[model samples]
Target: MSTTVVEVENLSFRYDKRLKENILSNISMTVDQGEWLAVIGPNGSGKSTLAQLLVGLIEADSGKIRIKNTVMDDTSKWKVRRHIGIVFQNPENQFIGTTVQDDVAFSLENLNMPYDEMKFRVDQALDLVGMSSLRHHDPSQLSGGQKQRVAIAGILALKPSILVLDEALVMLDPKSRRELLTVLQNLKRKENISILSITHDMNEAALADRIILLESGKVKNCGTSEQLFVAEPDLEPPFPELLRRELLKRNRNIPNEYMTEEEMVNWLCKSRLTV
Candidate 1:
């Protein structure tokens, strides 16, 4: 059985005391160790607010959050945050150092880590993000994708058990987005890091182990891709599945299976001779 890295129970929060509305209402969810959980919602649906609550940026008006079974309160939130790292949407806003190495080293310095250990971790993190070659490059000199990777490397330096992505890929172009996703996938497999990705992009959400749909500050649905894809209209199938369905419509006898585009391309090339 997998261990639960995070647990939220009956969580609720509101910004204004006078307002009768809650930004998040009775929200409950769990993220297992090494699992990828995607949170999706329309604008103003409390997705970002949830991220804030998870990272202790804001307090919940009601309910509880547990990280590694440690209950989150004012007293424990600081320790809880140590196990959770967050990466935001804009890469530039997150960068605090003049260069890639310095940016990755900033958090370690705050923790007052010894020089040798800090240097080792910073190097490892930069290498993990494939940014080691650019350690001396100024953050301003890198592309948007590179800058985002640098931000992620900064988080990686913390060696947190969980990573919270609050629309971290929204600012990137298509190719850059794919590259970052690949890096994340590697982290999940290699480091056993749990991922909570809050995204509006269905394609990105489709790649997760499970999806949570939020609307009007409440959970509308939560399930695996196969389950939610049928229940929610907004989530279209990946390109391969779409093509597979279209081919079936034309009386083509292709096998019906959930696959990525690359897999479909290989399948077509090997089994179906007709281009």
Candidate 2:
């Protein structure tokens, strides 16, 4: 059975206590161990707020957030945060060290971890993120994607069980974004790290194991990419899914389900061969 790593029930939060309307209303969700759950919505949908709440950066007005079966509270919030590693939208803002290797070791050093253990973790993290080659490189000189990888490596060195990405890929170019997503997918496969990615991009959401559609602070839908797209046809889908819909419109006999870019390419190749 899959372990439930994170759980939220009837969660509600607002910046202003005086305000009657809550930013997040009765929000509920669960992220299983090693599962990537993407919470997607437009700006002001409270996605970032939810991410903050999950990591205990901000306290919720009501409801409960449980991390690995432990409920979040003032006393336990610090411990809860230890289980989660968060990467924000701006990688540059997260960078502190001049070199990639130093950045990855910063957190471990702060924790007063033994020198041998910290070095082992830093090296392992860089290797996991494929940033070992750039470990000696200056962080400021690296590409946007590479900087993000370093940021991720810094978090990985701490060995957190869950990773929360708050629009982490929004600033990246298309190729950079794709590359980062590939890195994340590999991490999920190899490290069994549960991921909660709050994003507005359908392309990013489609790649997740499951998606939660948040709208006006409420969860509008929750399901696989195909199920969500089928249920909400008006919503924009990933580029491949959009193309699939367009083909179906022309009476093409393609399967009516969501397909990733590679899957779509393979299907097209098979169709041409059969024809």
Candidate 3:
């Protein structure tokens, strides 16, 4: 079994136009296969930059990245790209084919997969994302969530071992978002792929096996979601203002964080029974 599926060492990168300061600095991390890593950070924390660097979409000024034991350098990076796939934030920008099916089959065509196998894989990917019924429809015609599903299927078609999502679900409506997440959860369990999602949705973060929090291009917290939320005295509520207020009502001095609703609910229910 491979313990380290992704490894980053002393990684730092800067935009070509920007000089002197780096967007990411001295970052080192390891992700085991079959792990789900949720990257949470505020705007301008370099989350998107990190994603691009990981998958070889962009090269770093200095550092090293290895995917599934293959080193990434200028010459070999492109070769390594075969195992990495990214689902960017914008659905509109991601859809390249005239219709959803074409877009999903696009990558396999580039890889020169046989015709019979291509259709089978495309159908499987679409079915995983729950977008099979819309395979013939134009990508632009679908709703935000549906479009994201298409984008996901396109990536899944490649059958990469690593999945990078840069806020791919942010634009969807709540119900749509929930539906996609359900689909994603199923994929994760069945595929055993290493998942890295760059997002600010703390609610979604609750579902992650691990969370890496960033601030000003530096790691602020790296631990399981339960660990970081409770590390801070006021970080428990990932939902919104209303939930925070409710937690505080139970105990005037509610500690900083708590992971998942189950943890909070269990505590609150016990506290009430004792009272």
Candidate 4:
């Protein structure tokens, strides 16, 4: 008896004019509580579209969506949206407030939360993303990575159970990207929030509990990253060659299932025989 948080069944959708060409078809998947699921695909493969669907930004043409036993519909869209927070690929698109704090406070206002609680949540969210120092800075004045952090703070303030990140780490450099990854990992550990990330970064996808591959409006593959890396040699380019040695080296299973660099380092250190 798993706690299924998100349930999508036979979903189909397309633009008003492109009704003939569906952007997503028969897309069905389940994301359980505290599980991180990565949705990966090439450009224009409806990955972004699916993210929009999860948050009710775009309606599904057919089928159903159930969140915590409640069905998704136009009437419940606004209320249902509160349970899911989305961070877009481009941070610029997400900013609506002039200042960082104000931007993060925007969602709280719409949520109609109490002022005192809102203030605390806003402050805490900023702290969570390491943006508390920039709370007074203008959002436009920040760099790309900083803006993305502000965007994340906005969602964090909302305190949604589900976080949908559509290439949220794409803009940041290696350091900032890694830092944000740590922030997300901490949030997951502390809050037990479910994360659904739509990205092309195979390395990032590797970290998720489940990987779903989308291609031209359909699910191409879905499984643990290790399963795909070990079984199918004909996978898409940039396969998991990094884990090949640990996976295929005599033993059938890899020594560790974690996808983090620190975890891998620890595994290597512990594997050595220090005499």
Order of quality (lDDT):
2, 1, 3, 4
Better of 1 and 2 by TM-score: 2
Q: Which has the better lDDT: candidate 1, or candidate 4?
A: 1
Candidate 4, residue 275: CA error in Å? 23
**Best candidate, lDDT:** 2
Pick by TM-score: which candidate is best? 2
lDDT of 2 by residue, 36-96 (tens): 9999887899999999999898999999999999899999988887799899998888888
Tens digits of lDDT, candidate 4, 153-242: 898888888999988898778888767778888888888889999987777777788898888999988898867554555554233356
Model 4: residue 254 alpha-carbon error in angstroms: 10
For all candidates, what are the clash counts? 0, 0, 5, 0
Clashing pairs in 2: none
Q: Over all chains combined, what TM-score does candidate 3 have? A: 0.89
| Per-model root-mean-square deviation over C-alphas | 1.8, 1.6, 3.1, 3.7
The reply for model 1, stretches above 4 Å from the true place, is 256-263, 271-275
Kindly report which residue stretches of model 3 are placed more than 4 angstroms away from their true locations once superposed. 16-18, 234-236, 240-245, 251-259, 262-275
Using alpha carbons, what is the TM-score of model 4? 0.86
Tell me the spans in candidate 2 whose CA falls farther than 4 Å from its real position: 273-275
lDDT of each: 0.91, 0.92, 0.83, 0.82
